[model samples]
Each structure stands twice: as structure tokens, then as C-alpha cells.
Target: MNKLLVLICSGALLSACAGTNIVSLESSVKQLKDLRDHDRDGVIEAREKCDNTVLGASIDNYGCGTRKTLIEPLKVDVKFAHNSYEIPSSAYSQIQRLADFLNKNAELQVLIEGHTSKVGSVELNQRLSKNRAKAVENVLVENFNIATERVSSVGYGFERLADPADTEVAHSTNRRIMAELSHTVSVDDMIWTIYTVDQTQ
Candidate 1:
């Protein structure tokens, strides 16, 4: 009777060991499957902050942005007074944001082109526009500490205007300084990649 009891106990122990082995094997299999998925996807699991990423695209350099390409330069328009070179506080926020971008893209350069309305004479308008552009450039270099070498100022002198009208609203569009980025950006280097993605926006 004692031998029979001992044999039954041994049988129960064998069953438990077999069950544990099966569970361990299952867990290992699951881990392998997860690894396989990560490898097969080929999509980068992590994203970089500086990257202008597109749908299902991964950044090339970790912090510098995506490995893809840009189509056009990022243009920053700095509007101004009719004939004044003063930097307005209202436009400061946009400048501040631009300063941040400039800091990130150290390799980048900009040409700050100034414009004016037809209110002034050709010579006076050209001078005023140049000064206005220089004024903004001064702030960007002095306050933002952007490399002076990376920036150049030009005066179109009423040659280019979104609106060339006699009205104040139209003239306002002409009185502006615009920054054209030296480098082009890929479709991915943008935050909202889609055109009017946010309906409410």
C-alpha cells in the first residue's frame, strides 16, 4: 500500500513539471513573436522632435528630423509699418517662434526681404524698406543671437506685394519683411502634414 501511494505522488509531480515546461515554452514563443513584429515592420518605433515626418515615415537622424526630403523653403513673413523700422510687440511672438527655429537649424540661412507700398517715392521707398528689414534683422541678431553670417537683408521697394491697393488693408500687406529659408523641407517636416487636417482649424 505504501509503494502504491509513493508511485501516485511521483506521477503527480511529473505532471506538474510538464505543465510548467509547456507554460515556459508558450511565453518564450510570445516574446519571439513580438521581436519578429518589431523587425518585420521596418518602421521606426520612435520619433524625433525636430523631424518633419510624413505618414508612416521614420526620422533618419534621431534629433535632426526625418531622413526624407523637403520641397520648399520655410517662409516667415514679418509685416511692418508703412515707412517705419520699429519692431512691434505684436509681431514679437512670431519673431520669437522664428528665433526658436533658427536655433534648431544652425546650418540654415535666411534672406530677409523688405517691401513697401507705393505711398513713398521709388528711392525713399527702397531706402525705407531696406531700413525696415535691417531693423528686424538687428533684433533677430541681437536679441535672438542668430548668426549674422547666416542672414542677409534685401529691399524690394514695393516691387512685390500680396495686395497692391490704395487702401490701408492692401498697403499693409505690402509693408512687410519676409524670410525665405535657404533649405527646402520635405512634406514630413511639418506638424500637421495634411492640408486642413483639423476641420475646426
Candidate 2:
């Protein structure tokens, strides 16, 4: 009776260990210890992504997932008044489109910049520039439901010129808003699922 009970307990423990999947970093560390204790740096270690899967995704050595590339920023020229931060009615639909695009790209991040013409005091121009950026930020936040943390606003204050001319066309064109997607991607955010069942054991 004692022998039989011991056998049953051992079987249950084995099954529990076999079915474990470590998804977190700490959990993964323990999982790795349980899996590759005998040969720490062996070929099996290379194949551990299959042994303890976290995201159920295609993974590399570092355990990342499949990547979805987005054409971030979806930029358009948003123009405002010379000294005003108010978004004009004529540009409403255009900004709306950008907001709509931002909604669709939750995984992405952005930087919204406001520009102005070279016809104002530097201090006032800076203020106006910041306000213009804020104006775009408000629209994106209010209408699109995009998280404010995911968006950052800046004011160029006529520092960056598109046309670099004194003409109305140049000034009008410079008075614009631009949003760009973050250039960096988080390497740790991906879910990598590896299928090395044959190699793991």
C-alpha cells in the first residue's frame, strides 16, 4: 500500500511539472531551472522557448512574439491662424482623419509638433507654437480616445520652416501641425511561441 501510494504521488507531481508554462520573467527563470538543470548551457537551453511557452507566439532566444508593423504617424499638414491655437473648421475633417488613424494604432506612439510663421516675438511665438500643439493634442484626446501618455506635444515657434520665405504661401504652409510615430519599438513586448517539441525534451 505504501509503495502504491508513493507511485501515484510521483506520477501526479510529474504531470504537474510537465504542464507548467512560465510567462513572466521570474516564472520563466524558475521554469528554465526546472527544465535545463542538468545541462545549463546545452543545446536544450537553446530550445527552451518550446519547453516553457509564455505568449504562445513565435519566439527567439529572448522570447519575443510576432511583430505587427504600422506606418506610424500618418502625418498631414494642419494649419492654424497666425496668433491663434484654435483649430479651424476647414481643417476639422483632416485632423479627424488623423485622430481616427491614431485610434486604429493603439500599439504605436506619437509626437505632435506645432509650427508658426516668422512674424511674431520669439516668446509669443513659442507660446503660440505650444498652444497649436496643444490644440491638436486636445482634438486627438477628446475625439479619438488616444491616451495622452502615448502622445507628446511640442512647439517649433517658427524655428523649422517648410518654405523659408516671407510670402503668404510660405507662411501659410509653415503654420502647420505634424505628428510622427515613435521611431523605437519595445523589444520585450512581443509574444514569441516556439514549437520545438521534438528538441525540448
lDDT of each: 0.68, 0.68
lDDT of 1 at 161: 74
* lDDT of model 1, residue 150: 74
State the lDDT of candidate 1 residue by residue for 96-166, as single tens digits: 76777788778777778888888878999899889988987888899889889977788889888779678
Could you give candidate 2's per-residue lDDT for residues 1-201 as a string of tens digits? 112212223254465454444442222222443344233322245455434433434455644344545433456678887778888889878777776766666666667898989887989988998999898888778777778887779998989988898999898888888875433333323332364564456
Indicate the worst ten consecutive residues by lDDT in candidate 2.
Answer: 1-10
In terms of TM-score, which candidate is strongest?
1
lDDT of 2: 0.68
Could you tell me how far off, in angstroms, the CA of residue 134 lies in candidate 1 after the best superposition? 0.4
